[model samples]
Target chain A: MLEYVLSKYNFWTYAILLIIGLYAMVGKKNLVKKLIGMNIFQSAVILFYISIGVKKGGATVPIFLGDAHAAHGHEIIIDAAHYFIPLPHVLMLTAIVVSVATTGVALAVLILIYKRYKTLEMDEIMKIRQDTGA
Target chain B: MIWQLDVIFCLFVIICAIAAINVKDLLAAVIILGAYSFFMCILWTEMGAVDVAFTEASVGAGVGTVLFIAAVNKTKRRSKD
Candidate 1:
């Protein structure tokens, strides 16, 4: 039981963060809070994917390990066990870029909203929208 | 198993995350979010995710927080509950 708990505890940590982010997204009244929650959720997922690439003391980072036995004066990509998986890293590169872009755009839109509405509260914005019909 | 470091770092990350969301001041919340990202970035490094960690360290803590603060400055710094 101890072994099982030790091996799987990271999963539980990530799961708790997932729930926290979800709650922030659903329960927060401010749009920026929701955006921050989305970022937290994305980071949790990225961490989970990276954790999947780890092995039980079997792998190195995805790079050539040595010059003595490398064939064709080059290293070959082996199975998942001997090297950390690179696929998730590549995907997360794009995810990070997209997240930054989305945050920038959202912030810009938020500025525009605040300029017109003169308020940042979601409830206030919605009530004003109903009154103005625009 | 040396799970001790991971466990400690995980607890810190969780605390930072919770504090970031719960703080009433928007600026303080954004700054705490950056701290949370930094802690998570270090945790990712321990998990052998150098690239993801780099991205989080740069984008999540740096660019994301700046953008959030800029948005708050343009709007109201106070949140109505």
Candidate 2:
């Protein structure tokens, strides 16, 4: 049974990460905490794509002569190809950058909120908002 | 190396998520949300997404946890939970 379980480890891991990320994003009331959940959720998706590119018993995709067997029997093409697709890596590079930029912007917004309200508690802010009648 | 430990870690992530959602205190909820990110980092590693796992560990577990705490500090501790 354990052997069987190990065979599909990637899918199981993806499911576990995705669910945890979702719970954090949805179950929390704090806005910053919710953003943390959002980051986890995005990371889970990134992991999913990275897992899609894995190939058992295969080497990284690059245009090279490779081993003797490959050189003897395989034909070289200018367009690099391999057992696993490299598209996921390219896409994830963009995604990682974007996620970082988003985090920075979120922090900036949080700082602004703190300056404007002079308190970090959501309830206190709300209470003040009610008092000011603005 | 064996992968049994990975499966156990996956189970632990699920439990953490469930407990995070179930916890009554909003602060507790935020802290558990950080735990959720930590477990996700492990899951990404098990799946052979080492690059993604690194990014997630840093941003998700580190920056994300900090953001949540900041947001919590700005809000009421009392939640519907």
Candidate 3:
């Protein structure tokens, strides 16, 4: 039990974060709160992917630490044991930028919604739309 | 893994995230969320993801927070629930 718990503690931590974010996104009344919840959800996913790339006992950055010009075809072999996963890092980099962009767009939309309805509450907006037949 | 630092930082991240959502004030929530992002960046750095940490610091903690603050300024401060 101890070994199992120790080995999977990181996953448990992230799971808690995911649950918190999901609750905020699904249960919150404010539109901005939903946006913040989206941020948390994205961050949790990014962190999980990044953690998946980590290895035990031995790890190195994915970049070629040695001479590039003197490289040979025979030395192109990938030693998976020591090399870090550059793929997830690059993918998550793209994801982070995309998340920022999407958040900006979402916030802009929020501004428009607030301006039109004079409130940011989801229920209030829904009621307003119903009343206005919009 | 350095259990001490990792445990502490992870705990801080969780606390910040929870506080960010639970606080009634939207601006305070945004600030707390920014702090959460900073803690997450540091945690990623400790995990040896320097590039991810850099991106998180610049985009997530820096620009993202500023954008949130701007949105909050434009919207109502109090939440219905």
Candidate 4:
């Protein structure tokens, strides 16, 4: 049991992090806290994808080392196993951009909510809404 | 990848994530979140994802923290819960 658990500790850590993020999103009463939870959740997901692309052997980044023109006289052999997978990284680049964009838009909406409601707490906002019947 | 360093960085990341959400002060929480992002970048670099690390450093730690701080400044800093 110990060996199995120790070997896959990274997955365990990510799972714990995901749970924390989810708890914050659901249990937190403040809007900013919920936003922080969302960010944490997104990070955990990106981490999971990056971890998935990792290999257990001698592997480097997926980038060409030598120039193609310099090796024109001889055929260059590329080994797939020698490098980390690039697909997850490429997909995560877009995810990171989307995360930031979501953050910015959420913050803007938060500011607007604060402006109208004069508070950022969920309960307070609900109270105001019910009082105003809106 | 160094498993020891990975474990250490993961510990810090988890701590930062918990602290960031639990802190009552909005500004402090935002700063802690930045620290979390920075630790995450380091972790990614250790895991052999250099490009992801760079992007996380620039965007997550840099711009995200700034946006959160600005929003906190414009609004209330104290969280009731």
Candidate 5:
């Protein structure tokens, strides 16, 4: 029983952290609060990916040998290095770029909203727009 | 390895999703929606889809949340509640 518990502790902890982030994101009202929750959620995902990529006594992939163009460069045959995946790294790079683009677009939209409404409160803005019919 | 943990996590994800949709406050609902992404990321990780988890984390949690907040800040916080 102890062995089972010990072995699965990591999984349990990971789940708890993940849920905590999710709960915050799901239970908040303030826009800023929601953003923070989302950040937390994203961080949790990064952690999960990194954790999954880790393996006991495993070497990192993409091994680099002697200079490729050297006179006597060594030929390095890169291996999969344990079960830790490298696919996540590639995917994460793409994800990061996409998120940055999204953030930029989102900020632009927010700026436009501010210009049109002059307020950040959703209810207040709605009321103003409804009253003005614009 | 006990598989029940997956069930537990799934339960939480379901709760969060429901809260996201059912919350009266628009801002609150957006936040809950963000939570839904976070739980989904965890689910992906557990499924050994580390790449998918990473993508979801960055897009769903980071950019998606920021966008929603920006939209909310420009508009209102609540619809009914």
Candidate 6:
């Protein structure tokens, strides 16, 4: 059991991070802290995806470095084992961009919420809404 | 990729994540979150995801932190809870 847990420690770390992020999102009363949690959650997911592409024992980034014309003149054998899987990296790149955009939009909405409610606390915002009968 | 570096980066990332969420000051939390993103970037690079690490460094640590600080400046920095 100890060896099994130690072998895949990356996954375990990410799981802990995911749990922390989830707890912050659900348990935190501050609006910005919830956003921070959301960011952490997104990062953990990205890390998981990137980790999935990792290859052990002399694997490298997925970039074709050989000359295309030289390969055309002579048959060049490509070994899949030599390079890391790039699909997850590409996908995570897109995910990171989307996460940033989402953060920007969420922050804008948070600013508007603060402007309207005059406070960033969730309970205070709820009370203000209740008092105003909105 | 050195597993030792990976483990160190992971440890730092987790610490920063916890600190970011637990801090009462919004700006400080945002900055700690930036540090978390930086550690994550380093971990990605150590894992041989150079492009992803670059993107994370720029987008997650750079732009994200700036936006959060801007929002914090525009709003209140204190947290009751």
Worst ten-residue run, lDDT, model 4 chain B? B43-52
True contacts kept of each: 0.71, 0.21, 0.75, 0.75, 0.12, 0.92
- Per-residue lDDT tens digits for candidate 3, residues A58-106, read 6766666667777755567657887677788899999999999999999
- List ranges where model 5 is wrong by over 4 Å: A1-21, A65-79, A82-84, A126-134, B1-81
Q: Which stretches of candidate 4 lie over 4 Å from their true place?
A: A72-75
Per-residue CA lDDT of model 5 for A13-90, tens digit only, reads: 556656765765576434344444454455456545555655545443332444766635666565556455766656
DockQ of every candidate structure: 0.75, 0.24, 0.78, 0.85, 0.11, 0.91
Candidate 4 C-alpha lDDT tens digits along A1-134: 98897798779889988999999999999999999999999999999999998887888887877897888899889888888899999899889988999999999999999999999999999999999999
- List of clashing residue pairs for candidate 2: A32-B68, A33-B68, A120-B73, A120-B74, A121-B74, A121-B75, A122-B74, A122-B75
TM-score of 5: 0.48
Q: How many Å off is the CA of A123 in candidate 4?
A: 0.4
**Top model by DockQ, which number?**
6
lDDT of each residue in B1-81, candidate 1, tens digit only: 257898888999889888877887889889989999899988878877788889889887899898998888878887754
TM-score of chain B of each: 0.92, 0.87, 0.95, 0.96, 0.90, 0.95
- Per-residue error (Å), model 1, residue B15: 1.0
Model 2 lDDT tens row, A41-112: 676677678778766564443224457665776675543334455678668867876886787688678668
lDDT of 3 by residue, B35-73 (tens): 999999988887778898899999999999999999999
Over the true interface residues, superposed, what is the Cα RMSD of model 2?
Answer: 4.5
The runs of at least 3 residues in candidate 3 whose Cα sits more than 4 Å from the true structure, single-residue gaps closed, are A67-78
When sorted by DockQ, best at the front, the candidate numbers are 6, 4, 3, 1, 2, 5
Candidate 1: residue B55 lDDT (0-100): 86
> Global lDDT for candidate 1?
0.83
Superposed Cα RMSD, model 2: 5.7
Instruction: List ranges where model 1 is wrong by over 4 Å.
Output: A1-4, A68-80
Enumerate clash totals for all models, in the order shown: 0, 8, 0, 0, 7, 0
